[model samples]
Target chain A: MDIIVPIKQVPETSNVKMDPETGTMIRDGVGTVVNPLDLYAIETALRLKEAHGGIVTALTMGPSPAVKALREAIAMGCDEAVFISDRSFGGADSWATSYTIAQAIKQAGRYDLIICGERATDGDTGQVGPGIAAWLDLPLATYVASVTTLPGADAPVGLSVERLVEEGYQILELPLPALLTVVKEIGSPRLPTLRGKKRAKVTEIPLFNAQNLELDPAFIGLKGSPTKVVKVATPKVMRSGTVVRAHDEAEIALAVDRLLAFLDERGLLPRGDRP
Target chain B: MSFVWTLAEQHGGRLKDVSFELLSRGRALADKLDTKLASVVIGDGVSPEQLEALIRRGADEVYAIMDPRLAHFVCETYSNILSHLVKTYQPTIILAAATSMGRTVMPHVAVRVHTGLTADCTELDIEPGTGNLLQTRPAIGGNIMATIKTPQHRPQMATVRPKSSRPLPEDATRVGKVIEVPLIESLIDERVRVTGYRTDTADFVNLEEADVVIAGGRGMKKAEHFGMLHDIAGVFGGVVGASRDAIDRGWLGYSHQIGLSGKTISPRLILTAGISGSIQFLAGIKTSETIVSINTDPDAGLHKVADFGIVGDLFEVLPELQRRLHEHAAAPPAATTATADDERPDERQREERV
Candidate 1:
């Protein structure tokens, strides 16, 4: 079972700080890391390759810089790597992103399963996974908590998937040639191996662009997106909080009592003792 | 008639709530677009009864697929089934509740079908000019609203967060059509298993359905301290609520947490004590009809948002109020003064159990 794991390098959400003045995220000095959720997808593919006998191909659609994420996937145990980077692909929404990745998946051409994170941290819109499924016209399962393959097909891979169902989960079984958006509940991701690390440093990733995909230019970026962000801004402060200081412990208790009375008047206190 | 495609989500040998919710939302979208609503159900043991439910909910046609291979949800097989349906029908839009399963599976379908998808959307609007969906949702921790569209993609896809779309008023009398799609062997090529199933059952009411919500913040201190909040909820026949900090600290379950990353509560009344009312959280439950707050800090944001504010320690006020309310029946207060904290307690609070 050859599995393709698509990884995306996103801005470190932890380092993401809003510029109070501009009200936009300041990504100038913040570093980038592979989307945290994608880790589960990569790890799941590696586990599948280990259990069965197949190679894991790691793919990414970003600038040359995204090679880092691919190498990281290699260091974690993928067999091959591909990079689909070009200026035209920048600023693409889920649609273009899915098209680009889907074309690349077709380029890879012979995979039993495609694994991805449930969603991306930057967009938080989890659309690309299903978009890829839509583009590839393949079966898709999302938020898979667990996976176990079934036996007896030439490209044999039967998955018993524990899908996230809000309150709990729903178990599903699907055959080969499927796309799965994995969840952390699947399994713990493996640590990078020394041998794997050695291979990652020297591997040269294959790069593809719009021409390689033969995709229409108008449909590959902001232009291709059905949804356009007419505007993006931070939420304004609706109300500022008030601060009250107690002069002393005695004042603190008294202040509390007075406030309770105020709450009582407003029904903040459900108890009706003070007439 | 324009085609309407609904992703059939089956769980434990039945269709999930979101599936019906999707059908409901799909019905509205279909009516707006002047299309017929169609549903697809995929599972190994899907029953005709389940198909009837989908029709009752609003599906004009039900597509059914039964295969032992599909008894379990393998991404590859189901995605294949849905893609086939979409290709066959060519619907204009696809919507799924932003539940974990919807979030995960929709992306795969979107990718394969070469479409666009919006995630966790709170609202869906159809563009009058293009007939494209104007999918609106909160972004960046609910700090901003984003409206997305998929211009060229047929069956523009989106996943709605649960509770954002209310279940349409159920009317068994409402009628619709049911069409069952033929089944094929699911394409499954992966290694995974289902060891056991355990559901998270809260001792208290699930906050989602509670009429009254009482959330505790860092002020409450420990996991066990949630007992106080729980106790308070019991007094009002409500459910306990928590802040993100409480849930991340494992002081409360994610199910009970109310914030951007957790559940949102839009009850008739929300009584908050010791909560700071961060913007992210405010965005989550700001839709409540009335808000009453108790905080030691006079300048806490919670007070600003509260319809009525009290600046003091909750520990003293809450206990005393509970005591007084236990004394006797408090006369009905004016509708404007819903809580009526000043009124004397009534025998109702003190009523003993048999």
Candidate 2:
């Protein structure tokens, strides 16, 4: 099996905060890391290769700094890395992003499976995976948790997978050349080894630009993106209420009384009789 | 005339609550655009009453595409059917819940029709002059809100977060049309097959549906410390939730996680212990009505957003709160003029009565 795993470099979302005075994002010290869930996708691919024997290629579409993400994937045991970056690809939405990536995949070569993280923390849309599958016209599964190969006459022809749904898990069978977006339940990611890190340090990652991939200008970036962000504003922080601090047991008792009274005033306390 | 359409999602022949919510919102958009509000239902043996219920809830028309093969939600088939509908009917706008099925199918359909789609929108409206669909959604882990537009795309598409809005009240006297479209054989793609489904037995409570939620964070320290949250949740007949830190630390299941990557919840009351609210975590619980925080640090970010803050050790405060709750529960019934439960009406029931 030849596996293709798409990954993203995202800002540490938890650290993303707003400057109350200016009402703008505080991006000065915010650092980028491989989207945490993508690590799981890379691990899943590596494990599959270890079990079934295949080459895992890490693919990404971003600015030049995204090579760091690809190298990190290499350190995590991806056999090869493909980077697609160009100024034209900037401001692409999920539709254009998936289109660019799918084109890169086509230009890269053949693959039996494509794995992606369930969703990127920054976008939090979980739309790119399905969008890529749609662009490639490949069978796709989302929120996949587990996978097992189905044996054919001579080699494996398909995969039986468990997909997470609103209710629970749905067992599905998908043929080769299918794409899957995986959730955290897939497995914990393994750390990079010394040998893998050394290989990653020297590995050559080829870049695919719009010119090489023959991407149409009408459908590559913001020009190609159908949806546009017209306006952006910092979300308002609505709470600035009373704060009570308690130290000794007496203060603790007083604090508890105040909390109970607050709840009681709002009629939020549990049903009970009061003295 | 072009309609404002909502794809009604169903499971086991019953419509999901979000489907009705979409219809209600779509009704307003339809009215603003001077168009009809139509709901598309694709499932096997979906009852006439359910189809009519869609109309009663605000759908001017319900397009029922019933077939045995359509019972289970397959992305290929559902999107194919929807793409076909969009091509034929040319709806001005299409709405769906930001659910697994909706998330899967909408993008596929949008791509097929060559249009733009905004995912997980919190607000949707028609632009004043150009009549474009204005879709507003949280971005960058919910620290910023972005208003998006698909000015050139026909059938402007967006998926809304479930529970963000309530379903419109049912009007029994209202009447509408049910148009059943035959399923075309070419639309069915059999590359993927559903074999079986297994319910998740591990989830003790539905976080999204809970009236009250008690969540913990890294300050809870250990996996065992979550017991305090569970005890407090039990007292209020609510559920336990956790921040990403707690979930990543293996102290709680993913289902209990409340954050950007987890479930977005809007419970009536939510209490967080030791949670120094991250932007991502705040995204999920910001819509909650009453937020109470307990943290040893007075300046925790969570305290900044909490309706009430207690700067104390959760270990000491939670046990005390739990004991007080127990005492409250065990108190003599005669002394109370009216119990809280008796006075507080069921929120869902109130919505229905609206």
Candidate 3:
């Protein structure tokens, strides 16, 4: 099996906070890291390669700084890396991003499976994986929690996986050359080894641009994206109620009493307690 | 003629609540645009009453596509049917609840029809002059809200978060049309097959339907501390919920999680302890009727949004609250008035010792 895992570099969302006074994002000191979730996808690919014997390739689409993400993936044990970067790909939505990545995947030759993180932290859409599957006309599964079965020399040429749904879990079977978007339940990601880090530092990562991929100018970037962000603003703060400083035991009792009174006023206390 | 369409979602032969919620919102949009509001449902055993219910909940028309193959959700087959309908009818806007099924299928349909799709929109509106569907959603982990538009795409699509809005009350006297559309054979794709489904017994608490939710977060420190939350919930006949932080730490199952990536809940009253309230967690509980937060940090974000904020150690506060609640539940009906006074001296003594 030849596996390809698509990864992204994203700002540490936990560190991205809103400036209380200005109501603007405080991105000054926040640094970019390989989207934490994508680490699971890379680990899944590496584990599959170790078990079934295949080459695991890390693929990414972003500005040149994204090469750092690919190197990190290599350090986590990916066999090779493919980087797709260009000025034209800026401002792309999920649709256009998936289109360009699909084109890149096509140019990277053959692959039996593609894996992606369930969603990116910044976009939080979980659309790109399915969008890419649509662009490539490949069977796709999202929120896969576990890979129950994989095709091997003795097994059939299909894959079975467990998908995490709202109600429960669904066991699904799909043919080879399918795409899966994985959740955290898949497995805990592993740290990089010294040898793997050494290999990653010197590995040559080939780059694919729109010109080389022969992507149509009309379907590559901002011009090609159908959805446009017309306006962005800080979410309105809805509540500015009382904040009690309960430093002493007396204050704690008073705070608890206030909560009970509030609940009582709303008739939200337990039925027996409602007067 | 162009119309506003809502893809009604169903499971086990019943329409989901979000389906009606979409129609409730779509009804307003359709009226603003001076167009019809239609609902499309694809399932195996949809009854006539279910179709009529859609109409009573504000759908001008309900399109039913019944097939045994659609008894289970397959994105390829469902998107093919929807893409075909979009191409044939050319609706002006399409709305779906951002549930697992909606999120899975809408993207494929949008791609097939060459349109734009906004996911998990908290607000939807019709632009005043141009009549575009305005999609407002949280981005960058809910640090910012962005309003999006699809100027060139027909059947402009967006998925609204479930529980963000309430469904309009059903009007039994109202009447509308029900059109049963035949499922085309070619639309069915057999590439992926769902073999089985297993309910997670560990997540038996129906957090979404709980009238009262008591949640804990990282400040709880360890999984064992969640027991206090559970005890408090038991006193109120409620369920225990957890923030993403607690869930990520394996302190609670995902089903009890309240956040952007987990379940959105709108309980009548929610009491959270130790939770700093990340925006993602706020998104899930913003629709809650009332919020009370207890945290050690005075500046925790949750305090900004909570109706009642207590700056105290959850470790001490939770145990005290739990004991008080149990006492309240056990107190005689006549003694309820004196319960506060009865506990005041004991609480003060305990605090002074600390």
Query: Highest TM-score among the candidates is held by which one?
Result: 2
TM-score of 3: 0.89
* Cα-based TM-score, every candidate: 0.68, 0.90, 0.89
True contacts preserved, each candidate?
A: 0.33, 0.73, 0.65
Query: Model 1: C-alpha RMSD to truth?
Result: 7.9
lDDT of 3 by residue, A1-275 (tens): 78999999887654466545433344456788888778889988887778777899999998888799999999989999999999889778888998899999999999989999988877778888889888888888887878855555764367898877756777889988899999777888999899999999999999999768979889878889999888877766668678897888898888888877788787666534542
Candidate 1 docking class: acceptable
Candidate 1, residues B302-339: lDDT per residue as tens digits? Answer: 88877656666767655654544444225444455443
DockQ of 1: 0.24
For residue B268, model 3's alpha carbon misses the true position, in angstroms, by 5.5
Give me the candidate number with maximum DockQ.
2
In the range A1-275, model 2's lDDT, one tens digit per residue, is 78999999888645576554433345456788899889889988988889788899999998888898999999999999999999889878888998899889988998989999988887778889999999899998888889899987866789999887766777889999899998887888999889999999999999899778977788888789999878777778867677899777787788888888888777678777752
Off by over 4 Å in 2: A13-30, A246-275, B203-206, B209-211, B222-225, B234-237, B323-354
lDDT of 3 at A169: 77
Q: What tens-digit string does per-residue lDDT give for candidate 2 at B5-123?
A: 99998877767777888987899899999989999999988899889989988999999999988888888889899999999999999999888799999988888898999998988
CA lDDT of each prediction against the hidden true structure: 0.69, 0.85, 0.83
Worst 10 residues of 3 chain B by lDDT: B342-351
Sort by TM-score, top down from the best? 2, 3, 1
Best by lDDT: 2
